[model samples]
Target: MRLADVVLPDSAVCSAAVDVAETYASPALLNHSFRSYTWAAAYGTAQGLAFDPELLFVAALLHDIGLVAEFDSHTVPFEVAGGSVAWVFAAGAGWSRDRRRRVSEVVVRHMGTEVDPAQDPEGFLLARATGVDITGRNVDDFPAGFRAEVLQRYPRLGLVEEFVRCFEDQAKRKPDSSAAAAIGNDLAARMARNPLERPE
Candidate 1:
C-alpha cells in the first residue's frame, strides 16, 4: 500500500497527540512525528498487518517526546520518560488502563533492537518506521516515489542534527540510558552517513 492511500486517523486523542507533539517538539521533530506515522501506516498496510491506527498514531507522535527539553528526564532514559508522558496522556484521554500501558510499552519498545510484529504490531511498526526516518534504514522498502511524497509532506528540516544533539545531551545526563549505549555504538557517525541526506 502507498502512503497516499492511507488515511490519518482523526480521533479526538489523535488530534490531542498532534497538538502535544507540536507544542513540545522542535519543527524538525514535529515533522518527524508526522512522517513516522505515515511510514508505519504505509508499511503496515503493505504487509497486511493488523494494527490499531489510533494507537500507532499516538505512539508515533509522542515516541521521541522525551528528547525534548520540556520532558527530558534526569535519571531515567529519554524513552522511559517519554513512555511515562504517553501513559499520562493516555490516561487524560480516558483510554483504559491496559490501552494506556500499551501505549507506554510501545514508546519504550521503539528504542529496542527489534520487536516481533505478531506480539506487538504497533511497536514493531513504530520501531521500523523510526529507524527509516532517523537512520534511513530500509529506505528501499518504500518505493522512491512514495518516499518523496512523504518527505515532501513532512520535510526533514534538520532532524539529523537536532536528533543527534538531543541524544548526545541525553547520553551525558543519563549515562546508563539507551542514548548512551547508542552513542558508544557510533550512532552519530551512522546517522551522518544516512542515505536520506545524501540521496543520489
Candidate 2:
C-alpha cells in the first residue's frame, strides 16, 4: 500500500500534539517525529496489527520532547521525561486516566529493544518503526516503495548526527541512562552506517 493508504488520525488531540511538537522540536526532530508515526502506522497496517492510531500519533510525535531544552530532565532518562510530557499532554487533551497512562507507557516503551505486540501493539509498533528509522533495523520488512514514499514526505535531514549528539550529551550526564547504554554500544558508528544514509 502507498503512504496515502495508511490513514492517520486528525483529532483535536492530534492537532494539539503537532502544535506542541512543532513548538519544541527542531526541524529535523519534528520531521523525525512525523516519520516515526508514519513508519509505525504504515508498518502496523502492513502487518494487520491492531492499534490506537490517535494515541500512537500523539506518543510518537512527542516521544523525543525530552530531548528538547524545554522538556529535558536533568535526572531522568529522556524517554522517561518524554513519557511525563505525554501524560500531561494527554490529561490536557481530556483523555481518561487510563488512556493517559497508556499513551505515557507507549512513549516510554518506544525505546524498548522489543515491546510485545500482543501486550501493547502501539508500543511494539513504535519500537519497530523507530528501529527502522534510527538504525535501519528491519528495513527490509516494509516494501521498498512504501519506505521511499515515507522518506520523501519526511526527509531525514540531519537527524543522524543531531540525534547521536543528543544521545551523547545525555550519556555524559546520566551514565546509567538508556542513552548511555546505546552510546556504550557505539551508537554513533551504528548511526553512521545506517542504510538510509546511503543512495538507493
Candidate 3:
C-alpha cells in the first residue's frame, strides 16, 4: 500500500511531518522508506508494544528530512544527514528540545544495530519497531534491555500482526532480487551524499 494508505489520519502531528518529509525526499526514496518503516511498525505492534502507529510511522518517514537541507556531497553519513533534517523539521514543528533530540537519535541509530540501551532508547525502540535483530538474524537476538523498553513504553497497538503478515505476503510477489539490490545500493549512495542537509 502507499504512504497515504498506511499513515493514520487522526494525528496531525505526524501528518504534518510527512508533508515536510515528502516535500524534500525523492518520490521513490520516500515510498521505499515509508514501506520499510511501516513494516517495522507492524512488527513492533505485533510484538506487543502498541506504540502510536502514526507517531512512529511519521517519525520514520521524516527521519531523513534533514537530507533536503544538507544536500552537499553524495556520501554524507546517515547520522549527519539525518540530523540536519531533524533539526529543521523539529524547528518548524516547534517541538521541544527533548522531542528534537529523540528524533535525532532515532535517525542516527536506525540503521546500525549497536544501540546503547541507556543513551539511545528511542533508537533502540525504532530498531525493535523495525524488526532488525541486533545480531542481524534471529529475532531472539534482540537485547533484553531493548525488548523490555519497547514492551514498557509502547505496549501493543493491536494492528502490528496484520501489518507484518500483509507485508510478508506482498514481499512474495516482488520481482528479481538483483533489481532490488541495485535499487537499494543506489538509494544508499544517494542518502550518503547528504541530500537532506542542503541549504533551504
Candidate 4:
C-alpha cells in the first residue's frame, strides 16, 4: 500500500508521538520506524485483521527509542527501556491506563520470535514488520512493486549499518540483555549481507 493511501490517525497524541520520536531517534532510525509501521499496516490489511491505527503507529514509531542514548537504561534491555519511554509518552497524552499498558507491551515484545495477534496484535505486527525490514525475512509476501513504493517514500538511508551499530553498542553495554543474545542468533549474519550496507 502506498504511504499516502495508508490512513494514520490524526490527533494530538499521534502528532506528539511523531515529534517525540523524531526528536530522539536519528533520521535513519526514524525512517526505519515509519517503514515498520507501513509494513505492519500492509500485513494487517492482507490478513484481514483489524488493528488500532493510533496504538500501532505510536508503538512502531517509538519501538527503538531506547536505543537512543538519552533514553537508555543501563541495566535493562533496550526494548524494555523503549517501552518505559513509550508508556510515559502514552500516559502524558491521556491514554487510559490499559491503553498505555498495551503500548508498553507492544514495544517491549516487538523483539519476540512469535506473538499471537489475537492476543497482542500490535506486538505481533510490530515484530513481523521489524523482522522484514531488518533481516529481509518474509519480504516476498509483499509484492516487489509495493515494497519499492514504500522504500521510495522512506528510504533505508543506510539503516542496516546504523541499526547494527546501535544494537552492537547496546549489547556491549548490557551484555546480559536481549540485544546481546540477538547478536549471533538474529542479527550477525543478516547484517553482514544486508542490502542497505551494499555499495551504491
Candidate 5:
C-alpha cells in the first residue's frame, strides 16, 4: 500500500479526530494511532472486507486519547473514558447516533482480549493492528512491503518506552485500572521484548 494511495476521509468527524488526537497525544501515541488506522485499513483492503473508512479512522485516531491528561478518567478504565470522548466528538461532528455508537464500541473494544470481526469489524481490525504496532504480534500478517510503507510514513518513535511510561502513570493514578494491571502483569517484559522496541 503506497502512502499516497491511502485516503483519509474529509468529513468534519474524521478531521476532528485527527486534530484532537494529534493535539492531545504525545509524539509516540500520535504516531501509534496513525499507524493503527493505516494497518487496519490496509488489512481490510487486503482481506476484501467492506468497512466504513470514516468510522474506522475516527475510532483508531481517538482510541488512545484517554491516555492524555485532558481525557483521563477518574474511575473507569481508560478505554471506556476514551470511548466516551470519541462518542461525544462524533456527535459534535454530526455523526448519526448509530455511527457514534459504533465509534464508541470500536474504541472500547480495541483493548479487549479479542474482538469478533463479525460482531465489530472496526474493533477487530483495530485490535489486530494495535497488536502489530505495540507487541510485534502477527507482523507477517500484512505484506512486508505494505508494512514497510506504513512504518516508513510513521516510524515507531520510541513508542514502547513512551507507552510504558504512560501506563505507569495511569497505574499510579488509578491503582485498579486496566492499565495498572497490565503493568503489574508482564508489561515491562513484554515491552522489553517488543520487536518494535528500538535501542536507545
Candidate 6:
C-alpha cells in the first residue's frame, strides 16, 4: 500500500507532516521507522487491542516530523531538532490538544530511559515496540506486556515466524547506513535464537 494510504486523518497538515519527517530522516531511516511502526501495529493487533492502525501508523511515521525545522539552521542533535519541529508542526497543523500533547511527548521522550510503563501504557508500548523492531530486544530487557496474549492469539511458533518474516522484509528494504547496520545486527541475533527458514 502507498505511504499515504497507511497514514490517516488526511489534510494539508498531514502532508506537511510527511515533509517534516523527511527533513532529518534519511530515506533508509524513514523506511526503518515505518517498518518499526508497522510491526508495532501488528503486534498490538495480535494482542487484541483495537488500536487505530492508520492513526498509530501515521503517528509513528511522523513521530520525528519535527526534525525538519530544527536541523534546518541549527547544529543540534537530530533528536533535539526533531522535538522542536514536532512542536511547530503540531501547532501549525492545528492538532487537537490531546494529540498535540501526545505527539510532543512521543518525540521528546522517545530516546530517553525515564519511561514509566504503569503510568503511560501507550508510550510504553511505543517505546517497547520501537526497541524490538530496532534492536530485537525490549528496552530494559523486559518481556512484552502483552506477550502472553500475543502468543495465545497466534501461537508461540507462529508469532516467532511472523516476526522473523517481518524482520527479514524490513532488513531487505532498509536503506543502507550505520543505523540500518545496527538493525540488521539485531535482526540477525533474533533470528539465531529463533530460526525460521523462508519458503522457497
TM-score of each: 0.97, 0.97, 0.53, 0.94, 0.91, 0.52
Comparison by lDDT, 2 against 6, better one = 2
Instruction: List ranges where model 6 is wrong by over 4 Å.
Output: 1-15, 50-55, 64-80, 114-121, 138-200
Report the lDDT tens digits of candidate 3 across residue range 22-60: 677666446434544644654544456445454356567
List, residue by residue over 92-140, the lDDT tens digit for candidate 6: 7776777666665665555555667555444555666666544455422
Quantify all predictions' global Cα lDDT against the true fold.
0.91, 0.90, 0.48, 0.86, 0.84, 0.49
Best by lDDT: 1
- Quality of model 3 by C-alpha lDDT: 0.48
lDDT of 4 by residue, 3-78 (tens): 5667777888989999998888998999999989999998998888888889999999999999998998888999
Q: Which stretches of candidate 4 lie over 4 Å from their true place?
A: 192-200
Off by over 4 Å in 5: 1-4, 198-200
Candidate 3 C-alpha error for residue 9, in Å? 6.0
Model 2: what TM-score?
0.97
Better of 1 and 6 by lDDT: 1
Regions of candidate 2 where Cα sits further than 4 Å from its true position: none
Candidate 1 backbone collisions, by pair: none
Q: By TM-score, is 3 or 4 better?
A: 4
**Residue pairs in candidate 2 whose N, alpha carbon or C atoms collide under 3 angstroms:** none
Which stretches of candidate 1 lie above 4 Å from their native place?
Answer: none
Q: What C-alpha lDDT, on a 0 to 100 scale, does residue 98 get in candidate 1?
A: 100
Q: Each prediction's Cα RMSD?
A: 1.1, 0.9, 13.6, 2.0, 2.2, 10.1
Residue-pair clashes per prediction, in order, are 0, 0, 23, 0, 0, 3
- lDDT-sorted candidate list, best first: 1, 2, 4, 5, 6, 3
| Candidate 3 regions with alpha-carbon error over 4 angstroms | 1-9, 50-55, 66-76, 116-122, 128-200
